[model samples]
Target: MASEAAATGSTNTGILGWIERSGNKLPDPVFLFFWLIGILIVISVIASLAGWAVQHPTELTEAGEPVVIAATSLLAAENIQRLWVDMPTTFTHFHPLGYVLVVMLGAGVAERAGLFGTAMRAGVRNAPTALLTPIVVLVGMLGNLAADAAYVVLIPLAGIIFHAAGRHPIAGIAASFAGVSGGFSANLLPGQLDALLFGITEASVETVFGDWTANIAGNWYFIAAMTFVFLPVIWFVTDRMIEPRLGKWNAEAAGNAMAEEQGDRPLTDGERMGLRWAGLAVLFVIGLWLLFTFGPGTPLIDEEATPEARLTPFYRSLVAGFFLLFLLAGWAYGKAAGVINDHRDLVKMMAGAMEDLAYYLVLAFAAAHFVAMFAWSNLGLVLAVNGADFLSSSGLPAWALLAAIILVSGLLNLFVGSASAKWALLAPVLVPMLMLLGISPEMATAAYRVGDSATNIITPLMVYFPLILIFCQRWQKDFGLGSLAATMLPYSIGLMLVGLALTIGWVALDLPLGPGASVFQEIPGTVNPVAPAAAQ
Candidate 1:
């Protein structure tokens, strides 16, 4: 039945059709952002009636005022009046947005300077066929720390490198996609994401207990463990499952060849020389950072403080500072190499950068509205507290709770694709509830991260779902959303299992997530017996 449908092709009609047809057509992020907002508004209307009507039974009847006007006015009112008036105050309360933008500014320069593209090409350019699979996957996974840049650079590059090595390009795309989007949370080096999550966690925890802190490494150990676990699974799945099905490409495939001629011409002689200088510049910056982080009387690190202080605001700033450092190095390199002839060219690079982010912008806008609406309704908080109560009452083992959370997270991901948005909604309730159950905020956050990251590649709501469709179209000219989904289902299942296993193991081990972060024992007498609870 499936093959018959594939042969005639009615597969691209619904969600799958949306995925297949939209491949690289619209900017993804923008589209997702808007869609999420629209959905949130719909949900908000429903929630407002459900919540408000439940609270004020008499308001269900119309007074002298028109019913619609009265309901609309009432719904328009704010839950927290202070927060409603002080947009900047509430906005700043969600500090992750700033950190993300700050880092992107510097990253934007590195990419504009051709540093990232050059490095990727240099890394994968003449690699052996046997090692190509793992190398591509590893590179893709590591690329997550740099934000969404990997999708534009690595995915297509994998096809080129694989084709050059006399292998199927689809195999390359599959392998790289697995690493970048699939293994997004599995970075060995903690990046801006860690800091962002920690900030949210810290804030959420504080709402429950008077004083609480979440560490930068809140999800580190779990992510690191997944790094090793993902490598072999990606390799085997790409080689055995995806590649064999793809066979070889035809003349149509030649059109999508990954060539540097269109972007910036292969690094010029001057650029190579500039790279040497840039390399030295990077070293200098690293030396300075080390001195500040460890040297006596250095402001970057507070010498009198404990390990957590050494990492908190200091490391957070350091992560943002990386973007600036990269930008500086790239600008110097571009100037030295003569690639950046003038300010106009530099602006063009950044402009071109914006073109790629069109989709992301769309997704963000919708996602922002969706998240805002979701928060406005207060359903997430209510549901989380209720769920936590049930879980806590069940007397289930921690491992079982962790597994259940992972499963629910993966399932929820199918509907809501934005990681930060989902977590923001989840954290305020789950974190604190779990904390009361002897699960640290760090552990709960870690479990949530694993579940969230594991299923991203399979979920059509993922902004880049369309991008993966484009990748599939190269080999299977008939490839659409269903094709992409079918191809990725195995990897999703594999990663889900691996992610859950690692999470369970971590809970069992009771390891520290990062400095001063732990898996067990929330502060005693933390929960308010009257109120359900806030998240960790």
Candidate 2:
């Protein structure tokens, strides 16, 4: 007994040593993202001043149609001048600080009020060890519907739960991280990210197919199918492959105590009532949203109306709705739970939520500015046209093109963590090009989603990567980018393979990608010359 006790002490000390070392090696998340953003701005300014981006359009419109408008860059001072100012502003415009803060307000309420923790405990506690991998993966995948909360809460809790379960907590951390980040697009629900991507797809598809509509559910089934495929692959790799290689965790490295969570007060009578009311409030809010979205003549649904007349864009921008639902739910819960006694508590909750997001705000401001500049420079469009021509002339198979797309998207994810931003950059090119080949835009969107999601866990560019690293430090102490990369590599490969395989399966089945979007079709008014491209 004495020997065993001594060994345990030594082991714990080793673990703590590892964690401390890892923390020292890794760059701070806030600082890293901020630096990258700053660097991008500097490069954009240099290019603008160097006058290297000058390209005049040979023809502004094709076939007397308004479909193609090339930027006359470098050739005109007016073009370069506009690009200089507008480029950085793009990044700022989309990552709305106020919107992010408002959304976090609702999120903070649920987190602070014990709802998130309670739910997490309930989930991990009930899951059997054998089912743990799939369960963790599924939970993380589903959590995407809630936006960034998975990073904000789930990742750390996963480490704690694993430690309590008498297992290597880093394995647990990797599994959850895999599901949450790598499987981001695999959620059953079409959340804000989907809407953003679909909007870009719709706009791009319109160049070839005027009536193109990228529904929110465009990638739903593809994502769902990948979800199941990924779960087992993650389970097998993490349990049999990754964990075995990882060995035992040191004792001192047992991770943060589960004790802080232990004495948390149970829901009081008033709080219970508040929870019920909050649940109803949530239901009521969702009901109203559904009514507006699905109801006939409801402005939110667009009722077969024109772009201005349609509700598509309105429904697509559901982040505001997400903010409202949580706000009302949090308010009601706080009221019943007695945690919120007055308007002051409400204000405090919102303030607390906004405060933690300061780092994200800084990063987002720079990113937004960069994206704005990129768009203004028209480089993205020009690059897309040239790339599309190359792909077309190569006469490659659809599978080959898709495989290339997946690889390209995965590589791009290493630099750009925001899914929407990447899709925005890629969609305008991929969607229209794919349409010309007789491939549906929906399929293109699905392919992009798979690639974007697969690499998120391993990418330092992801906004949440540092947060995940910090969570890991609480358990292993030695964990760093290499550690995280090593641990997550298996899950990443699994998701990528399974996701890509499922995509190929969908194409083989000749299934509908979404409403009015199919994998293959004949080009309009052309029977002999089949449109060789697939709609992305």
Find the candidate with the highest lDDT and give its number: 1
Compose the digit string of candidate 2's lDDT tens values, residues 1-536: 22322232233334433543444354554454456445545654554444333122222245543234233233246645765766555444353444455556776776565554444444555578767767877888877755666766666666665666677777887888888888888876655566557656655544333455456666666777777887888788878988888887665654245525432233357756766777898898888787777776565765576754366655454656667777788778777777788888888877877777676666555545444444444544444444555666789867677777888998777766667657755776676566555667778888898899898886654667666776666565556655666678777888888877887778777777654446775533221121212211
Question: How far is 361's C-alpha from truth in model 2 (Å)?
Answer: 5.6
CA RMSD of all predictions: 8.1, 8.0
Instruction: Please give the range of 10 consecutive residues that has the lowest summed lDDT in model 1.
Output: 65-74
Best by TM-score: 1
Q: Write the per-residue lDDT of candidate 1 for residues 53-147, one digit (tens) a residue.
A: 11120112455331211111114556346335754444444545555555556667667776666666555665678899998888888777656
Candidate 2 wrongly placed segments (more than 4 Å)? 1-71, 80-114, 146-148, 195-217, 247-276, 293-320, 347-382, 415-428, 438-442, 460-473, 477-481, 510-536
TM-score of each: 0.76, 0.71
RMSD of 2: 8.0
Model 2, 81: alpha-carbon shift in Å?
A: 5.9
Question: Candidate 2 — number of clashing residue pairs?
Answer: 28
Error of 2 at 454 (Å): 1.8
